[model samples]
Target: MQTDEEIGKVAAAVPVIISRALELFLESLLKKACQVTQSRNAKTMTTSHLKQCIELEQQFDFLKDLVASVPDMQGDGEDNHVDGDKGPRRGRKPGSSGRKNGGTGSKGKDKKLSGTDSEQEDESEDTDTDGEEETPQLPPQASHPPAHFQSTPRPLSSRCRG
Candidate 1:
């Protein structure tokens, strides 16, 4: 039901909106990083300060990889230095299928269950039967009397009685 021009406009606007949001987020994060740097008595905001801030704050944990380390000026003859202008390479490394447990999928669930004590209890419970795993029953809820029902009733006022 959408025209090509309308669809194109939306697609173009998406990147702009995302970039603006990212810019605002980065600005605020950098301000916090500056404050952290000042607290450390450092005149210049270093990558270590930013890294420390990111690690300390749970919200900024995702930006850990984004703040790359500054290259060692001593020149130890090692190429450990990452360029500041170009950020770290994104995406998964080679031979990674973007799956946990080596792409075995749901089999990982069984592997995890095999090591758990609850799974052992489940296996023990099934031993008495035909080896079929029964659904674990949740603990019975403790019934508490309602506050209003338990409390003494208040006496009615003379005005209400009249």
Candidate 2:
């Protein structure tokens, strides 16, 4: 069993790992985005291009820690780590339920409202306290990922955990 502080440390480290991984991931994505944007001068890379970049980046980042975590076996030649290639770990596919919104159904789809759904009803109400027009509250952290696809994971920490 782990103490709270120890668990907290591991939890904290997860984001750092994610952050470092995301930094590289975004770098590659931006490079591709720039490449596409420059080639066509379009407003942005098409959804397919962005999606490909994201998936590849996610794989790369995932592999970085994964490869490091494997134990070395002096007697086994398989223990050697090579650059750019490794056996695939069983990963949850992108958009799997575990990664889905914390019970907020898919974005933009109309959800059925029960009469008792008072909280849900109030959420849709438009509130404008300031004189400025209410910009649609962009889905919390939605724009952080390329244009509306909600599959992006939050950054985990960088430190090592048992």
Candidate 3:
């Protein structure tokens, strides 16, 4: 049997450790979700982006049921409210089709590649040097500690012989 103080310390440390782990998991998940959104030429992340990330990645499949399906919000003059339910609205009915806002099958006619895509295209073009020797690119340098972080070596002064 452990003392009360020992049990209390363990209990407190467990929550802190769990919270830190949760924070890290959420951070990585969101980062991947953001990448998925940007890949599809979206400025703002939507449920579809998150869904795509969850669906495509096997590691995130467990969260599929937890990610609520959100209604499409791109139509003109259509309000998102659903009979006074101030919560996330459900997506379109299982069978409706046509050029409607938020429909999975419909793509926006005005959709265009975002800046990142164009930049990536430009980079690819630059890399194609038509038979020239390609130089190996170096990985980005890791960040180093500041000069102030370095400890100076101390010299021992001559003192009375011990």
Q: Give the number of the best model, judged by TM-score.
A: 3
TM-score of each: 0.34, 0.25, 0.37
lDDT of each: 0.53, 0.44, 0.53
Instruction: Give the local distance difference test score of model 1.
Output: 0.53
RMSD of each: 21.3, 24.6, 21.1
Q: Which lDDT tens digits does candidate 2 get at residues 7-95?
A: 53455577779889889977876797566445443333444334434444654454444344433222322322233545323344455
Q: Note the residue pairs that clash in candidate 1.
A: none
Residue-wise lDDT of candidate 3 within 1-162, one digit each (tens)?
136665644555777898999999888788998887666545456676676677778888799887657543343333333334454334334454322233222122212332356644643453344433334443212212225566675555534346
Error of 1 at 10 (Å): 4.6
The deviation in Å at residue 77 for candidate 2 is 51
Off-target runs (Cα >4 Å) in candidate 2 are: 1-12, 51-162
Candidate scoring better on lDDT of 2 and 3 = 3
Error of 1 at 148 (Å): 99
Between prediction 1 and prediction 3, the one with superior TM-score is 3
Relative to the unseen true structure, what is the Cα RMSD of model 3? 21.1
Supply the TM-score for candidate 1: 0.34
Q: Write one digit per residue (lDDT tens) for candidate 1, span 9-112.
A: 45667778989999998998888888776675454565666776787788887876776463322232322223454432344445543343333322223433
